[model samples]
Target: MGLNKITGILPHENTCADLVPMAYFYDVLKNIQKVEEDIINMTYEDGRQPLLVHLDMLLTIARKYPNTAAMCIYELKRKHLKDTFEAWWERNQKKIPKKYRTGIRQNADELFDELFAIKSWAKSE
Candidate 1:
């Protein structure tokens, strides 16, 4: 269905509205990759590779957060993100609090992994 690439949302705005539409876009990305994989069927140059639709955007954020290792291009990577749960908690436990962490289950890696998977769609952040 034409990949249905109607629009994209700010990945990390996390506002009520910004997040809602992203779910649909991810689905579209998955389907397009699937179809492309079947058509090319080449391991060396597979459809599994996601093209950066907007080079300018990627370059902008890339320079802004030169060392950013966030999952997505537009999402700004935090500077103090830690790798171990203990380390992260040491830094955040006070601000976020242990009581709040009581029933939570993710380790630092998993937590940060999903923390900024998406990025702001705004021209500048």
Candidate 2:
């Protein structure tokens, strides 16, 4: 029923071993925006939400391309989904295989740290 329950059931990173290119992920993120908008505008009959689906996509992406997954987080933050993204990350980080978590954490820290610093600095101006 809840987002956690829905996303908790999805496949883990280890299960997604296919190599996904960065461009493919970029395209997927672009297309997901439309679905996200629709989900935001109307109530879903099946109780599913865009964020839940997006989280699954992100996990798959992270499995193949952790750096690209970091970019997806940037995209989510750009779309004002920071809180949701953070919650999703917290909920699913443990579900990701331990082997992949190091790369994911490194990529996320490298990408988001600078971005967040700049955002904070801009807000102060």
Best by lDDT: 2
- Each prediction's TM-score against the native? 0.24, 0.40
The residue pairs in collision within model 1 are 11-119
Each candidate's lDDT (Cα)? 0.37, 0.50
TM-score for predicted model 2 compared with the true structure:
0.40
Q: lDDT tens digits, residues 46-77, model 1?
A: 21122222222333344444333232333332
What does candidate 2's lDDT look like per residue over 31-125, in tens digits? 56665555445433333335545545655665555655554445544434444445446656776678877786666555444334332112222
* Count of residue pairs whose backbone atoms collide, per candidate: 1, 0
Name the regions of candidate 1 deviating beyond 4 angstroms.
1-14, 42-125
Candidate 2 residue-wise lDDT at 80: 48
